[model samples]
Target: MADYPVTQGTHGPIYHICPGLRVNLNDDGNWELMLRTTDKRKRSSFGKGEEAFKKAIKAGELLALKLGLLQVEHDKERLLSEVAAEWLNLNRQRWSGTTHERYSQVVRDYINPKLGFLPLSRINRAKVREALTETAKIRAAKSVELVHATLSGIFNEAIDLGYTNENPSAGLLKKILPPKRKRNLTKPDPFSLKDRDLMLEAAYKHLPGSYPLILETIAFTGMRLGECLAMRREHLDLTNNQYFICESIRRDVIGSPKTGDRLIDLPEYLTKKLGAHITRMREEALAGAAFTDFLFPGIQQNAVRLMLKRACYAAKLRSRSPHDLRHTYASSLLMAHYSPVYVQKQLGHHSISMTCDVYGHWIPGEGKKNLDETLAGQPVSRRPALEVVDKKIPLVAASGTKSGTIY
Candidate 1:
């Protein structure tokens, strides 16, 4: 290695590893990392901090490659595309078909085209970041997230198999990607009470048999659309006005509901409505319509979504989706001062934090009502203290003096 020059600065020494490559320590007493390709034509970055030093090390390696100081790849390294495919195929049994398919699509469309050609050892955080940044430019935040996850998954597999030692895509989404504009945070997506009513009315008139009932069930209970579709007559308890929710439909497949199954409470009105609907289903079954054990036969998620849109249009209400009805149910509960725990149970959420994260904005950030007014509290009731008396006989006290009284 050639000897690199060093210089003293106002605060500390500047270590010049080579031309256009320096670790600077200045008045702030922190390391400043600056790196550029030879000839100083391509300056990559200038940053100050311990993290900058780490990034600089990686950047400097890249600069070294450009300067002909390092080889790009060795025979031992495998191309990232090949590694990714191997990683995905190996996990096929570990993931659901839909999950595996989604990840495969992400890798094919977003990840492989960009970083797949590089050797696994040569891939770094900057390359992953650039790919994700490019994805964000053209894709929605959600799609970007999927692309990021696919990359991270591949890199993780690489580490476990000893193909690479670092995970370049780790923490890249949260730390590097710009904050997504959360529409739910700005304004709750749940429909208004009037909007809900209008939509139900429109669905009843314009939609086919049991379509309105399906929407009503979602509106009254925070049941997911998938769960609603998967429901069977046995799942209902009309007497208790509760629905036993366990299974859900997804991607035209019956499966367990998200977060597992829990019974959902239904209002008495909805229970009666379900009772009549079931009777109607029985009547249709006798008349020759195909007998479907499901509560809403032939209605799927996409169909429910379309139903909501049509209802919204007919009612002249703001458009929404089936899942948005779930949101509406939660918002109604929050507005009624239902505790987070209750809402969490009703929605079958995994955690209280998740419940709050999605619907916290609907809740009052500050105390909105005085305790007296809200609770109808008054001075606590009290009973009178019991009276006590004591008597003592003095008959023999000082016997001579008490003789007359004693007798």
Candidate 2:
């Protein structure tokens, strides 16, 4: 190795570490790596010696290829999978477990299977279009759309890092004609008061202890089932008929609530019922019942959903998930002419527009006296038992709120 004359920067003097790599011990005493190539100058901090030399060499290779000194190995291949792995790692902390799982599923099952092996440059518009077309033949429209989004995101990250120049998947969605299918949630299917009573009655007979009351509380309060399950003794306020939503349980993991902390007010009837339930739990604990961490401890979202299914069956009503009770609460208020803004706060939605977008259909038509008429009044004729329900729901276009809203 040959010693070179020191070059001066405001930080410190620069010294040669290798052929294309130089090092500067900055005023902060940190080793700064400077890659010397054509016209571009790249500087980064890496700890000293052999590790710095390796990183500098790797960076130097990229700089050389970028500056046209060394030919970029198109024939040797830089697969998109390589860039994708880096992208996922880079943004792993930003995504939740459910989100990470979904993104991983799309990548592993759809995107990687078709485009993983291809060089990033080779994944042109035609190739992407063909791949989407093939996938559309097998998957639903929404699933195919997710595949397209995953490809676009991967390609975007790669382009940002200079791994590839163009995003071939970009703007191809307008042209890709995926399969047409029904959307899973056309609108919120909230239960009527009569149906609520029927289900609660069936819950008393069919479900285990406290579930009947639990269902009513969810319908009355608009708290998410997860939030309800995460309730603790300290979260309750019997005097005010309300509870504080500090945390939520998702996929068996306890974390902060979706919309942060908020107070959920309940009807007086519900407040008394919950208070009585708490008294019962306390009495049970005193009589040798195991102490529980949460008010609704020893239960999971799946078990609640399964129990709700049984109650729906026994009530001779449509099978509604536990989340549907939230819809029931929101719709009940809306039809009663409650303000959407108030409902937004109660539902823990980020904004009024989201509540409106979801529950907009629940807003009563002009001159309607009771909101119950809309969700209720299903024809009394019962279909054959054990018959598959294939009826398609129609999507209602939101026309915004019709009447003046109260604060």
Candidate 3:
């Protein structure tokens, strides 16, 4: 084993070299030196393992330092657009099609147009703020904010990959004016007791069997439009009264959820309705000498939309989109006084906060009532104080012992 002398540094021991060979002076007061003939390729960390060990360790350390310096310089020259493309490609497999499509759209429509040609070093906080505000002028404030987030996330990836030291978009806050909140979009839906009956009657009179069942299931269960459309015979467990939502049908593609990775449980009423629909579907299939696996097969989503429109129109109700039925479900749950946590899980929301954000308003004067109720539940002590009254005697009966004031 060849031994290499170890010299003490500020924190640890580093290899000591002879003064026979020297390079340019480093940041330290002493001269930066190197061994001229050492094979940088054969370098290793061991300084005392064999005859070649000392020379190898020295070569490796020098080569590694040179590479690190080169990387730092390269990072300084890297552009934001280049880093962003690399980041998106790295994460593409983990993202869903809709999500990836949306991100690509943002990059093409917003990010590239403004920041594509600019180097990462040149993109400062002020430039980002300007770009964000410009977008807000063209689009809705929320949309601008979303683009800001998308761009920030891309830059953040660059930081993580060692292409940048800091994320320039990290601390920039969105400059949004207060927005006016709107009433529930589902309020016009004919899902009320009377309206639903009328709508059902109209649907049965005009539409075929499968259509009515499809619409009713969406309204009843608050399942997403795609989830209801994608159901197969295998997905439903009629005997157990539950269905597993492993896949959804969106625009002809059998896919997963937008939020992704969730299994929703169906209520008993929905389970029975689904069972009945499956039975009716089987009867139709057998009578027509045809077999199908889909619960709502042989219909496009656009056709379903049209049917819903016609039903709402014939029932003398305002037209509401299918997604609104999901909102109606959420509102109904809150109005029925169901726990937010239960509803959140049923809806496959990532968090209770998200459920609250969407359905919090429908909770019906709950905030103040909750506060009052909490105060009322606490015990408090009560106290009473004694009181005295004074009466004056009449002056006319001053001579009388009972009426006279004593001197």
Clashes of 3: 0
lDDT of 2 by residue, 1-407 (tens): 11334678776666653456566766776666677656557788776665564454445434544454433334455777778788788878897654666677888888776667556765688878878988978876677789889889888898888887888988887676523443342345778989988998899898997677778778789988878988887888888888899887766677777777998887888888877888888899999998775778767778888889999999999999888899988888888888888999999999999988788866748346544554565432432347665765454447653544333
**Descending-TM-score candidate ranking:** 1, 2, 3
Q: Write one digit per residue (lDDT tens) for candidate 1, span 155-181.
A: 889899988888988899986555676
What CA RMSD would candidate 1 show?
A: 13.1
Measured by TM-score, the strongest candidate is: 1
Candidate 2 lDDT at 392 equals 58
Q: Candidate 1 at residue 208, lDDT?
A: 84
Predict model 3's lDDT versus the native.
0.66
Error of 1 at 6 (Å): 36
Q: Report the lDDT tens digits of candidate 3 across residue range 1-407.
A: 11235666553344443222222223342333344444332212332323334344334334533444323333457766677788779888997655666677788789876776456765787777767867867777567767878888888898888777877776564344343363122232325556766776788778875788788787777777887888888878877766777676755666687666555667788788778777877887789947678888767778888898899898888777877677777778777788889888777788999989877876667655456446866533332335544656355554655555532
- Local distance difference test, candidate 1: 0.76
What is the TM-score of each predicted model, taking all chains together? 0.63, 0.60, 0.55
Clashing pairs in 2: none
Query: Which candidate model has the greater lDDT, 2 or 3?
Result: 2
- Candidate 1 residue spans exceeding 4 A from truth: 1-89, 92-127, 138-142, 162-165, 179-187, 363-367, 371-407
